[model samples]
Target: MVLYADPRRLRVSAVAEEVANGCAELAKTFRGPGAFARGDQLVRASLSIVSNIAEACGRGTVPDFRRFLLHARGSTQEVLAQLRLVKPTTEEDRRLVRSLQSRTVLVLKMLNRLYGHPPPDR
Candidate 1:
């Protein structure tokens, strides 16, 4: 069966890709061991959002897609929560976190829309 109509054309896929890249950038800011470990967790959560979206699109059924979208939405929230826990030591770090936050929110909105839910208040 066909997976996605064309995953590349999906807005959620684009946003998820951006979120994963942003997580990689954010992960580079850590110095000590503990912070680095937390950064790793954040990166994993961020990438999970992307993977779940791709899996959703590949399911070839609306119900399956919505189930996976819920998982992606949860992952998006996880990334945002991780971002909130980070203490950015520089202006650049602060800006990066803000950008990631914005992108994650966009992904959340897209998933919500796809799942037939009302837009969430940001």
Candidate 2:
């Protein structure tokens, strides 16, 4: 029981695309022992943020959509933390991380405004 007609659908897709690009950049610098696992986690979590948004938007239930958006927000926070943990040696890597971080913050703000404050459990 989902509606195919919502403006938020397009917005979520665009946000996800941005996140995917950011994750791709991060994946390039992910070498070394511990860097592999950390990078993988970061990439997945970052991608999850955008994916969840889309899925939730299509779920058709108000509460379910809000719950998924909450999950997306949590994933965004996790990506930020992971980005902080990555000690980038190259200037390019630093720049990419900063860009990704900025984009994520913007997405979070948009999500908050779109959904407002959910219930206590969410």
Candidate 3:
């Protein structure tokens, strides 16, 4: 039997979804007056990664796709930087942020590989 996987379930999509969910989860932990604004920025950047990847995949040519993937990779890095500004008091919160960071790195690596570019040195 031939099994077909949903195109939306591609590796980039899955990673983007995970990043979105992680941002949402992190936003829920904010409580102060300025929290909402900061959280919104984080959410927007995280969601951009998802949309950019989808757009890249739909583009007609390899170069176009690579350009958008680079944008998506930049957004991933942006989200990671935003996440660092949040002070997670609990172990659970710390773990969640760490997980998101790890996933972002993985996605960046995947995008670089797809574009035939070497992963950036840390």
Candidate 4:
């Protein structure tokens, strides 16, 4: 359980959730041909990151948690790749995409750190 409000858990979960929401929002903009598939993939991968983290929290062992974190890390990287493929037209879209990309990267880093150095209680 997250008894003490662990900052690592907070950052990983909160930021990953934000990334998922942002990716979902971004996906709606891709109504054009060829873009729909990419957007769908983006949403799936982004959502995976959050899902993995949540799964990690419910695990009984540190290794299990770290394993799920690694899964989340992979999903985060996929989101980054999808974000790279996005070619935003307007400044507003560009800002939104960039913000999502940056936040996704942050979540990846947080996942890596948490995986490498888990909490004392596991």
Clashing pairs in 1: none
The regions of model 3 sitting more than 4 angstroms off are: 1-9, 117-122
> Tens-digit lDDT track for model 4 on 1-122?
43122434567899888889989998888767888799899999998998888888777777777888888899999999999999898898899999998998888788878877786672
Deviation (Å) of 2 in candidate 1? 8.5
| Candidate 4 lowest-lDDT run of ten | 1-10
**Per-prediction TM-score:** 0.88, 0.82, 0.84, 0.89
Q: Write the per-residue lDDT of candidate 1 for residues 1-122, one digit (tens) a residue.
A: 33343457778889899889989988988877697789899999988988887787677766677788899999999999998988889999999989989988999998888788421222
lDDT of 4 at 112: 77
Residue pairs with colliding backbones in model 3 are none
Once superposed on the true structure, which residue ranges of model 2 sit more than 4 Å away at CA? 1-9, 117-122
lDDT of 2 by residue, 40-120 (tens): 898899788878877776676677877888898888888878877887789998888888878878877877875674322
Query: In every candidate, how many clashes are there?
Result: 0, 0, 0, 0
lDDT of 4 at 65: 79
Which of 3 and 4 is the better model by lDDT? 4
lDDT accuracy of residue 75 in candidate 4: 90
Q: Give the alpha-carbon lDDT of every model.
A: 0.83, 0.74, 0.79, 0.83
